[model samples]
Target chain A: MTMLPPPTSKKLGLVIDLDICVGCHACAVACKEWNDGGQFGPLPDANPYGAEPLGVWFNRVHTYEIEPKEKGAPAMTVHFPRSCLHCETPDCVTVCPTGASYKRAEDGIVLVDEDKCIGCKLCSWACPYGAREYSEQRGTMQKCTLCVDRIYNESFEEIDRQPACVMACPTRARHFGDLGDADSAVSKLVAERGGYDLMPEMGYKPVNKYLPPRPRRDGCAAEPTPAQEEKVDFSTSPLLRWIDKVLSR
Target chain B: MRPAFSVIFFTVMSGCGYGLLFLFGLALAFNPAVSGRIEGLVQLGVGAIFVVAGLLASTLHLGQPQRAWRAFSQWRSSWLSREGVASVASFMPMVLIAGCLWRGADATTLRALGALLAAFAAITVICTAGIYTSLKAIPAWHNRFVLPGYLLMALLGGAAWSWLIGEWTGGARAQPALIVALAIASCVLKHFYWRHIDAATPASTIETATGLGRFGRVRSVEAPHTEENYLTHEMGFQLARKHGKRLRNIALLLLGPCTIVLALLAITFQAPLHWPAACCAFAAAILVTAGLFVERWLFFAQAKHVVMLYYGGARMHDA
Candidate 1:
């Protein structure tokens, strides 16, 4: 008898704040570090320094400029960073010809068993997210496991076990927690800030929620204050005096 | 939707094999009181060879062929699983009935079992077709026309096979008429499937995919990556537009009327048992099967998966 895997409560997911992300690609590098160290092994590279360098990576941060308004963007550019949304109804698992791909019944994290994978590349095709990357050297599939090996390690401190991207982010844009639990930090954050998922119409019901960029403050003045004179000596350069005279004229 | 060669071969060979048996089923059913026991045995015996050969070829594609039985386990949500289950289940009864029929067992029990095999034969044909029809993601495949198209194909393709066997042992009396009708129907079906798929809106437009408004201006200025990725290799097979149209027409010409004429020629010469008709029909179907493979390839290649929008293929069309 076959049964659909139970939907789990310990839903590991990410909350990405579009407001603070600067597209530094730290998360992508952090992800590669952890995935390489754990179950997925090293993502091999072909022609590392040659004409066309290629390799498998579980995460690749995409940068896209947004106007966000009809007028050309007056403010700094809004960079969009994309990764696997870890959708609740991931089509990749169901489309697998082998049982190597599965959704976790414990944490709602989708994963592929590298040992059982035949490298047929069907899961990659099935995933509309383009989440799964094939490791050509290993001939197996690799994806963000939600840092399963780190999140559950008994040796690490409770807070230290979160995904490397979440821990390493300097701007604090990425939040990690269980979305299924109402009292969880992510759920509260989502409820308060009006967080939204990307491409919700796709109906994947993505676990990760993106907090839309907050609207800029109105009536904010832009000026250079007189306090600037405290640090610089105007008498130092004749060129500076000439610029000041030209400004006054 | 990956154009795996093994799968293409599996579908074609099985389709032809199943078609031949389906015609044999109709012939046995058409004559309730016929007394050609030795001849019936030979026809059934020969047809089974093609069926088994096609099925055996399919196993070569499996990664872990030893675990092939596990495919039957997940029939609930999976159409591929159901196909494997139905195919294996259908094989058992067919073998039993054919084995008995070949031994000249025309008893009431054997005849009843043979009828059961015929019903199961239809199930096998439909189940095989269901593998593609069930995929809701591929708009070209998941449609109303697929069900009847497959059923019609089985009956029509089966007619040619039945005609061959009928000429060999049963006589060419009713086989030619069945082939004529089947040929026309098959031609019409292929046309409808092609037409419907060509005109349908892509499942999602680039705007809808990118979360832009339906009428939003979206275009791909630059691709995200320099080299092709796994997603592109597995899904991004593109066929030239003009060539596909020409090839589809070529398939109809080669497989459709060309086959019917050969069967008709065999009829005119009173050489139903002659090699020309069977040879021509067999060769034409193989060519058409190749053509259908290309058609199936285009079905996947032409489909714009929603994710392609993110990598700057955000071109929008009228939904």
Candidate 2:
């Protein structure tokens, strides 16, 4: 029963743009807020009021500083948000001893059937992305369900049908669409921006993609050009000169 | 990689139990030393206690202990499930063999069942080792040495306990040289395993992790969260180099040369000083078990998980 299902053609996933992300914890916080009220609600927080508070979160944001290759080049800061990739060959699902952890065949969204989970914690270990979170209170494993409830809800508006994290992104750095469709908007963005997979050598074949930061521009190149200075010259314009004389009177 | 006490105890105690049971089963099948009732009682009693105690200890880490029976359902894909099924099946033949000894039955049934128990125990140990080796996430555990190292330690522990039983029951003369040889072999294999892991490189680097390999260098400017999360807590355990070296030395001394010396003394004075021989054998068995525990602890503490790259761990290749 733990054997993986055949590969599906439709892979629903997110595309994260590193260039525009502002290192804000909005995505992480939005994820927690929405999921806490939806399926797998109320992510347990043990010792929340104590000196050391601990809780489970499905998404996390990390920041990194990449030093420039040239001596005078400026350093770049990259904010990385990590979550479940819903891999094509998820080791977490295969390593599971119970049928609780499984991938959906219809949409390729990996989910946990909490009713059947034994809380063995093997799935968490098998995941390279640290996607699965163990809830001691529920005695089951939880992870990003790609907002299956909201995305598939018929009552919601078309624009409100995306994941909470994607909708809440101020810069629109997070995008949700059918990554399996090469002609989809998300896929086109990936192609244009040179989007890449994280740790591709791991061979999980992650459905999610990340767009690398664009090349940094030089400091002086942003200054005004000589061509712009030729415009709005009062000395060369007769209308501007007449307006200046009338204002002086 | 937290080296939870429950898991450490489960692996060590169960390994020793399986090891001891294996030797007793082999002896019963090939030789006729444990034909007497008292010898059979002592052998079965020790083996059952260690094995059962270990089995119980393994459940301590489980969040839902009552649901453990469900683990046996997926033996085809899970080594843990296979271990559960194999270990439970082994007890069937073991208990039946014990019953035969209790009733003074024929040796033929006992011998055949004993052999079956031996095979099952070996398989269970292998399955347990496979649980760690099969993990591609942890580079240190996913190696050629893990399987052989586990088996060697099991054999060594079993041989030591068997020698003690032989001395106490006066049923048979255990070959001390064989115990010493197994101890030596385990120590040598452990040394090579340490060297191999030390020299090995991590499969992925920080650049590869971020898909920024085209860029020159990448470093973390800030952490995702201020507080520790499940991933960090479970996999962030770090063992200091000094402590690791000291523990390795202690384990080597206790398991290798010290055990060899005690075993040699027992062999030299078995006839003239039976009391001293029994005492020495008992002490050596205790030392070997303790040493193996330390070794297993290092095995977990020293492992580096790939998830650490997201945290502030230096490049995986740097190790």
Candidate 3:
């Protein structure tokens, strides 16, 4: 039962644009808020007001400073949001001793069936992306469901269905759709922006992709002339010269 | 990577148990005269105690210990599940062999059951090693050294313990030279493993992790959170170089020279089935087990998981 299913062509995933992310953590906050009470409710936080607070979150954002490759080019900061990539050949699912962790063949979403999980934590170790979250209170392994409940819920408005992180991104940095479709908006965006997979050499064949930061124009090799230091010609306008003389007196 | 006490205890205890079980089975099948009925029963009882204790200790590591039985369902794909199944399956032959010893069964039946038990015991140990070797996320464990290391160490510990038991019961002694050879081989394998990890570079780096290598050098300026999260808590354990070196030295001394010398001393006094040989074997057994404990601890503590790349551990080996 832990064996992986054949590859799915309907791979639904996210395409995150690093060029526009402001690192405000709104997406992460929205994910916690929704998943905390939505289907995967009560993401427990230990010591809420104490010195050390620990909890399970489906998404997290990291910021990194990149030194420009060219000497004169300015350094840039990239806000990186990380979550489950929903890998095609995730070892996390196959490594499960219990048939708890699995990847759906329909949408290529990796999920943990909490009811069957024995909390062995082997799946957590198998994940190179650190996506699996262990809940101390529930005694089960939890992870990013990609908002499976909301995405397929017919009760919600058609426009309201999507991952909480993607929906809440103010800069619209996150895009979600069926990446398997070549003509889909998300796929086109990926192709146009050169979207690439993170740690491709890991060979997980991640469904999610990231668009790199665009080049900036601030580092162009050009000097500006100082216009502020130019002297005014009083002889050109006699009226302007008379007004200036009166003001000086 | 965190080196949980429960897991370390489980592996070490179980390794000794299975090792002893294999040797016992081998002796019973090849030469029944080496052990009397009472001595055979005693050996089986000891091995069973250690095996049961180890299995119980492993359950403590699970968050839901009551659901451990579910783990046996996925043996088709998971090495951990296979290990669970193999270990439980092995107990059947163990019980049958015990019945044969107690009931004075025919030599042919006893030999068949003993051979089955030995095969089962060895397979269980292999499954145990497979659990770590299958994990490609940790480079230190996903290597050729880990498999042989586990096998050799288990045999050495078992041989030493069997020597002690044989001396105490006035039965046939296990070869002292075998113990010495096993000890030296384990030492050499451990050295190779340590050297391999020390010189190895991580396959995944922060640049690859973020897919930003074209931008130039990437450094984490801000962490996702101020408080430590589950990933960091479980995988970010860092052993200080000074302490790691000291512990490695201690493990090497106890397992290598100390064990070899004690084994040699046991050989010198083998003619007299008295306190001298027994004491040497007993001391060797105790030191070997203690040394293995330290070695196992280092094994987990030193492993660097690839997920550390996201948390400012730019390179896996550097972490």
Candidate 4:
């Protein structure tokens, strides 16, 4: 049975603007908030105050620093927020020992039905991205639902019916729309900005797009700029004075 | 993967079941037995229970259960296929040998047939292990240690199960010897396998796994997919090095020493204690078996498969 609309109905997905993302983690928190309170119910924490704190989370933002290839350039920090790509292939669904996990062929969104899950943890083993997390108490697999509840809810305006993470993005780094439709906003953004996916060769065919970090201007840190030089306190700064003395001596 | 009851039962039952009858066939060949004329028919009857039941349990793992029969056709290439065929074929001589033993006659031809059946049964156990050990794609399984280790596992499992049977049979003579050999063999192989894996380096590094040239620092930059891919699902396995190390130590401590103790007990004690000692031997076997399952899981998890190369993991050498 088709629980979701087909690929033609502007199959919406996440388009993350890696350049604009400030590593704020607002999207992740908002996801937890909406998903926790919404139709999926609580995402469940094993021990919120325990020694080994582990539970389910759909979105996790990782921070990484990229050093310039050329000498004398400052490193740039980039934030990567990961979630289910709702891949075209969706290996998690195909490999499920029980049919609890499946993909909506129409829009290419992967989901766990939760009813048939025997708490096998097999799906978690199959996921390379570590996307699927085991719910200890409930004995089921939990993952990014692509905010299924909000996207189709008619209670709100048409445009606002997007995922919580995209809606909550403070820097406007996150965009939600269909890539299956060529003219969709997400597709256009992807075309204009060259969005990439995580570990493409693994071939899950993730629908979520990650816009690569925009190249920063070179020589940002080499031979301090005149503005930086003027800002530097020459005489009173012990570090500078000591260096100068050492050179003179 | 959780250790399913069916598999645990099958591995233990089949291994020792085959081991016992195989030994019976061997003893018959060597003329080493002092008493109890080789009851080929009865041995065949008992062997059928182990072989059939174990095979049935193995089928429970298959998604398409009916296709299991088709597994036998691949004997030319697949070890799994070879295992199926070997297991099935071992039954033929077994039945023939049983017929001979039941005639209340000592036929020279029947002894040769019985030995062949026992030999096939033992080979089937090895082939069952070869199914896992042959997968070169999985570095943990691809290792040289896997072949011997799995054979040793089958032997140990067989010995333990046979001990239980021996205990039930009012303390049989050869059970102790079988237990000692299997225990020592299994424990030693496990320790060696653990040490080998522990000392090994990742076949490839994150940079090389991605096929990115050496020297340039490579980070995820951004992951290519969101939901789990097959490579990550299959190869991104992690035994969490520390936990793997800890479990390995536990296996060594429990299985190794207990194997020795059980052997000594079997040598020293004669009756009720022998039965309990057999039970204890199996208890150690159970622990080792469970540990091996964890070890197998870690084997897959920590393997960092060649496919994980694209996911920014390194490739490893077989050695």
Candidate 5:
């Protein structure tokens, strides 16, 4: 039962744009909030108010500073959101000793059947993305389900049925749809933005794609004027001069 | 990469057990009259105890210990599952061989059962090695050196155990020359393995992990969380170079020169039932086991998982 399912035509995944992300951590919080009480309820925190708190989370956001290639050019800060890629040939599924980890053929969604999991933690070791989270309290492995319960729920409106992370993005940096479909909006976005996979050499063939940050045009290479380089001068403004005199008196 | 005590104990103890089983079976097949019935039973009993204790220790590593039986169901794909199956299957032949020894069976019957037992034991050890080799996420484990390292170490430890048991039971003695040779081979293999990992360049880096290499030199400015999470807790263990080198020296000394010297001393005292020979062999066995424990700890502690790249690790090797 740990055997991977045949490749599916419907490779539903997410496409994130790095240019607009502000590192607000709203998406990660949304994912945790939705999953905590949803189908995968009670993402237990070991120490809520203690010095060291550990818990399971399906998504995380990391910030990286990219040094500019040209000297004197300002560096760029990119906020990267990390989560499960739902790979085509995931070793995490095949490495399971118990038939706990599996991928669905219908939509290419990888999931862990908690009931069958022995909590061996092999699947966690096999994952290069660090997506799988083990719950000590429940004695089971948990991972990003891509919001399986909400994605297909008929009761919710079509617009509200996407993943919680996508739904909560303030800047519309995240998009979700069937990546397998060439003409889909998400696929078009990927093609236009030149979206790329993380660690492609690993050969997992990750379904999720990330759009690179756009080039900056803030004239970072321009030289500063002599006046700009000088220390604080009240001579440029009368209000600042009056305030400085009053303070000195 | 946390080097859990339960896992280290399981691998080291079980590997020694399988090695002892293999040697015992080979002895039974080649010379059925190597020892009396009681002596044979005692040898088999010790091996069984080590194997059973190791298996029990492994269950402690699982969160759902009661559901450990479910692991045997996925042999079609998983090496861990295959290991479970092979280990359990090996007990069948072991029990049969034990029964044959107990009844004082004929040489022909004992030979066939002995061979079967040895084959099962060897297969189980191979399955154990396969578990680490199959993992691609940890480049340190996914290497050519790991497979042979596991095999040679198991045999070396087994040879040491055999020498001690032979002395204790006054049965067919495992050649001291053979133990010396195995110890040398294991030392050489470990040296190469360590050198290989040290010099090898990591396949993945933080730049590639974020797919932002085109921008410039990418470095993590902030982590996902301030405190240690599961990923950091499990994979963030960093063994300092100074400590690692010292431990490696200790392991090599105990496993190589010291063990070889003891084995040579045992060989020098050629007289049968000599107390000095027995003492030397016993010391060699203890040293080998202790040495392997340090080696196993290094194996887990030094492995850098690729996932660390996302959490500010510059490269896989650096992590």
Candidate 6:
């Protein structure tokens, strides 16, 4: 039963823009908050007040400092938000032995059936992205559901009906829509921004795409200043003159 | 890649068990007159105990041991499921062979049943090896060498156990020699396996990981979480080079040359009722078990998972 469903025409996924992201952990926190009490609620935190604490979370944000490759190149910070990409050829699903892990035929959202999962943790090993989280307390594996319960909810306004991470992004850097549709807003964003796949060489064919930060402008370039030999330039400023007088004494 | 005690015990103990059963079945088929019925029963009983104890040890790692039966359902795609099914199925032929021995069946009939039992035993070991070999995510495990290493170790361990039985019952002179040859082969194969892994490179890098190759060198300034999480705890084990090297030396010295020498000594100078041979065989088993334990620990400790790229380590590149 862990056999993957046939490729769905509707690959609903998220498109994350790196340029506007401010490295705020709102997405990760929002994901935890919503999922904690939502479909996969109560992401337990073991030894919450102890010296060493651990918990299960569906999303995480990592920050990287891209150092200058050249002598005077300007550096940049990239805040990467990671979750399950809902891959087309997810090894997590295929490696599962109890039919506990599976992908949906309609939405392409990969999910783990807590009831059937034996907590063998093989699926966790198969995932290269480290997206699968095992709950030691519940004895089941949990992962990013892409907010399935809220995305299709008819009671909520269409504008509010999206992944908690996307809705909570202050900069609107995270966009959610049908990625399979060429004309969808998310697909258009991907096309215009040259969105790329993370670990494409891994061959998982991740449904989610990430838009790389735009090229830094000339103003941000680190141009080396010429060394000047001139001295005694502070003669006109009284504060500098007083400091110079004190230093001369 | 954290080496859980349960898994270590399972692989080592079960491997010896399967190996012993394989040799016992082969002995019954080719040389029924080599030993008496009592010795055969003892061999089968020991094999069964090791295999069962190993299987039980494996279940200890599972979060829900009550639902362990569900693992047997996905043999078509999962090597683990196949192993579960194969191990259970193997019990049938083993029990039948034991019944034949108990009834003092004719040599020809026992030989046929023995061959069937041996085939089942070999298949079960292959399935066990396949469980680790088939994992593509862990490059350290996914390889041709893993299967051969496993097969050879099982054969060697089984031969050693059979030698002990033969020595006790005054069975055959060729048996200890066969065990010595297998021990030598297994040690050589294990060394090669270690060398191959030591020289291997990373399968993926941070540049490829984030699709930021065009940008300047990518390096982590901050992790996603401050405290350790399940992923880090499970896959982020790091080993010092000095400790790893020392452990490897111990394993090689004890399991390889020491065991081989002990086994050879037992065979070279035979005594009445083979008492000296039996003592040497017992010593060899203890040495190999202790040596392989260290070797198996190093196997997990030294492996660097691709997930470690997110943590701090050497950069990975696209395959």
Q: Which candidate is the best by TM-score?
A: 3
Could you tally the backbone clashes for each prediction?
Answer: 1, 0, 0, 22, 0, 5
- Superposition TM-score, candidate 4 onto the true structure: 0.59
* TM-score sort, best first: 3, 5, 2, 6, 1, 4
- Predicted chain B of candidate 1, TM-score versus the true chain B: 0.82
**Interface DockQ per candidate:** 0.25, 0.68, 0.76, 0.04, 0.70, 0.56
CAPRI-style class, candidate 2: medium
Residue by residue across A58-140, what tens digits does model 2's lDDT show? Answer: 89999988876766566778999999998988888877776777889988889988877888788888887889888878777
Ranking by DockQ: 3, 5, 2, 6, 1, 4
Mark the regions of model 2 whose C-alpha exceeds 4 Å error after superposition.
A49-51, A218-231, A235-249, B32-34, B172-174, B240-242, B317-319
- TM-scores for all predictions: 0.81, 0.93, 0.94, 0.59, 0.94, 0.91
Could you give candidate 3's per-residue lDDT for residues A28-133 as a string of tens digits? 9999999899887779988878999998998999999988788767778999999999999988989899898999989999998888888889998988888887
Which lDDT tens digits does candidate 3 get at residues B122-240?
A: 99889999999998888889889999998988888778788877877866556779889988998999999999988987788899999998989888999999999989988888863
**What's the lDDT for all of these models?**
0.64, 0.85, 0.88, 0.63, 0.88, 0.81
Q: How does model 4 fare in lDDT? A: 0.63
Residues B1-319 of candidate 1 have per-residue lDDT tens digits of 3556666666655665667655555455555334265565555555566566656666665545565565665566555566666666666756776666656565665556656667767777787767666554455666887777667655655555555556556442236656667667777887887778777766565444444332134444444456766655555545434366676776577557776676677667655356665565555445445545554454554554545556664431222
Sorted by lDDT (best first), the order is 5, 3, 2, 6, 1, 4
Query: Pick by DockQ: which candidate is best?
Result: 3
> Which regions of candidate 6 are displaced past 4 Å?
A224-249, B31-35, B106-109, B169-174, B240-242, B316-319
True lDDT of residue B105, candidate 3: 84
lDDT of 4 by residue, B1-319 (tens): 2334555566656765677567666656665231243433344466678778888887775434554564554355446567778888888877776665555436466567757866897788888677655443345655788767656666565555555555545433356666666667777777777677667764444443222222245554444434543334435555344476676666665556666576677667766454666666557556645554554454444554444444441245322
Residue B58 CA error for candidate 4 (Å)?
A: 16
For model 2 chain A, give the 10-residue run with minimal summed lDDT: A220-229
TM-score for model 6?
A: 0.91
Higher-DockQ candidate among 2 and 6?
A: 2
For residue A72, model 3's alpha carbon misses the true position, in angstroms, by: 2.6
Residue A161 C-alpha lDDT in model 2: 95
Pairs of residues clashing in candidate 3: none
